[model samples]
Target: MRIMAKTDVFIKARIIKGYSQRELAKKSGLSHAYISLLERSVKSVGPATAKKLSDLLGKELEDLFRIELL
Candidate 1:
C-alpha cells in the first residue's frame, strides 16, 4: 500500500463542513483513528474504506486517493 501526502484542501473542506472525526467515522463506517491516520498520511485506505470515505465526503475515489505532492 502507498502512503499519500495529506492535502490541506481536503482537510480544510472537511473542517469547514463542521465534521468531527467521530462523526465522519460514523458516516463512513470507519474508525476515527483510521480516518485520522489516513488524513495524516500515516496509513493508506483500501478500496472499501476509500469508497465509503469518498462517498461521505462527496468526492470521487480517485480524487480522495490522489497525492498531489507526489
Candidate 2:
C-alpha cells in the first residue's frame, strides 16, 4: 500500500493551529513517532487517525492524507 500525505498542507495546518508534532500527538492521542511517520509519508494514516487529525487541525481528511490502498 502507498500513502501520499499532503504533507505541506498538513504541516501548514498544524502550524497554523499552533501545534508542533509532539503537541499534535498528545492532543490527538497519537504517538509522536506515528505522527512523524505520517508527516513524512512513511506510513499510511488509518481512518481513526485521519479523523483525529482532521478534528484537531480543522482540516478535511482529503486535504491531509490521500491514502490509496495498493
Candidate 3:
C-alpha cells in the first residue's frame, strides 16, 4: 500500500476561497513556484508550511491534506 497525497484538497480549498496561487503565496509567504509544485503534487509540504497554508486558507490542517491508502 502507498500513501497518496491529497493535493487536490488544497487546490479546491484555494479555489473556493477565491485565491490565486500568487495571492496565496503572498499571504502565506511562500513562493508561487512552491505553491504550484504543491498543487501539482510534485512536492510535499512540511508541517510548518502546511500550517501556514491552512492558516491562510482559514482551514484546519487536516482539511487541507489527507492520506489515502493505495
Tell me each candidate's TM-score.
0.74, 0.88, 0.79
Which runs in model 1 stand beyond 4 Å of their true positions?
1-6, 67-70
What would the per-residue lDDT of candidate 1 be over residues 1-70, giving only the tens digit for each residue? Answer: 5535246655765687679888888887778887788788778766677777767777766766763444
The TM-score of predicted model 1 comes to: 0.74
Give lDDT for model 2: 0.85
If candidate 2 were superposed on the true structure by all CA atoms, what would the RMSD be? 1.5
lDDT winner, 1 or 2: 2
Candidate maximizing TM-score: 2
lDDT value, candidate 3, whole model: 0.79
- Report how far off residue 55 is in candidate 2 (Å): 0.8
Task: Please list the C-alpha lDDT of all candidates, in the order they appear.
Answer: 0.70, 0.85, 0.79
Count of backbone collisions within predicted model 3: 0
Task: Extract clashing residue pairs from model 2.
Answer: none
